[model samples]
Target: MSQDSLDDAYANATYIPGAAEYPPRWTKEARAFRDNLRENDQIIEDFPYGEGAREVFDLMMPETPAMGLAVFVHGGYWLRFDKSVWSHLAAGLLARGWAVAMPSYDLCPSVRIRDITRQITLAVTEAAAHVAGPILLAGHSAGGHLVARMACENVLPTNIANRLKHVMPISPLSDLRPLMQTAMNDDFNMDEAAAMAESPIFKKPLSVPVTVWVGEDERPAFLDQAMWLAEAWECGHVVEQGKHHFDVIDGLTDPDSLLTQMLIGGDIA
Candidate 1:
């Protein structure tokens, strides 16, 4: 396909209704959530995971002892958003007694996607030191791609890898090859070699459990991307009915939501 078509295929906000409102709504909700947690002294803000300016994470603790740690990474095609806008997403797992860590990594054009992956590795390593038990990962869009990378062999330290219980990549870009065809590649600066090297679909995953989740209402390209990762890794796949790329992650806010249950592992009923 032509570059224009490829770019159109990957364009998410353009296809979603009222897409402009979602980010502002997310910011408002996230601020309220973080402020409330701060009031109770339950949230730790801007904890540095790495030396870079954006290499910080926010840890939100539960009322009771935490069962484990769940780290969430936000997505803007690896170029936008940060840990702050996703603070509220921790509500579900927090209610279920799991501590949640949201980390912000340097964006593309500023740093390569591989660089962001390494930053997340450091973030997870640092966050894991603070919380005990298993570690569950959930990331949206480009963030999905990063968490999926963590599931690959040698990407994370053995100690951290061993503690992983589940990885749920929500609407992830598992294969980076296609992104090269999109205009976003200008900022990504990914050649064929770099794209293949960074793609989760091309790498063999470690022995941890993985579930690829996507919205049924997402573009065909995203649907195929989700399926490719599931088939390549031979893992579970969930295409949430009626969800679009922008709203599929709403399930993370509800403790009883299937997405949360799958990630944190609890009684489904």
Candidate 2:
């Protein structure tokens, strides 16, 4: 595809079709997923946070001491979804001898995107305090964007940022400029200044390790976002596999997959 076509696809892939048509059903499925995951795991429900918003994180540990901590952030384009839906992800990391922490932040429109970012930062920082060893940050979609931001902040001497081992941004939205063209902007509220400020691609390279992952079948925009962030950071790897946006995350569940190996600090071919 041409460069322009690729750009258009990334900007529009996050746009949900018929979003106004199924609020009830959507809520039912989301809740079901959350409840199902919670039933199987020992999760720390409703971890407190700023204002009225709070985050819930599920911690999964291996039988022995953990090799490290993997803090995961869920993505609903920064609007929907929560940590509960992603608790199943902990099983894979747990088997690999790594502790996993999944945290949910307040969705957009209720809270601005900036505040949402801050809330996630607080959630990860708090979780890091209780877990042993350094952290490997990972997230899907908007969650990927948040992880990238946290990795960039590792340049600072803050306790949380300093403890970061690496970052894996799966199908991340690195550049917010194109998102302004979509209806998602309604909740994202990406003013030109905020877009530039929040975008990881526009920021300086992070000293920490970063690995970008996108499915081969994902929209061009999604792939570009991964590449853009990888280039901007000037210190990461990118993997394009034969999966789509959602299925790409499923690949991480497989211990032998490249996604899992990268998370565990193994060689990625």
Best by lDDT: 1
Q: Candidate 1: what lDDT?
A: 0.95
Q: Compose the digit string of candidate 1's lDDT tens values, residues 93-119.
A: 999999999999999898999999999
lDDT of each residue in 38-85, candidate 2, tens digit only: 676634566554455456565666667888889888887887877656
Cα error of candidate 2 at position 197, Å: 0.9
TM-score, cand. 2: 0.83
For candidate 1, what is the TM-score? 0.99
How many steric clashes between backbone atoms does each model show? Answer: 0, 1
Per-prediction TM-score: 0.99, 0.83
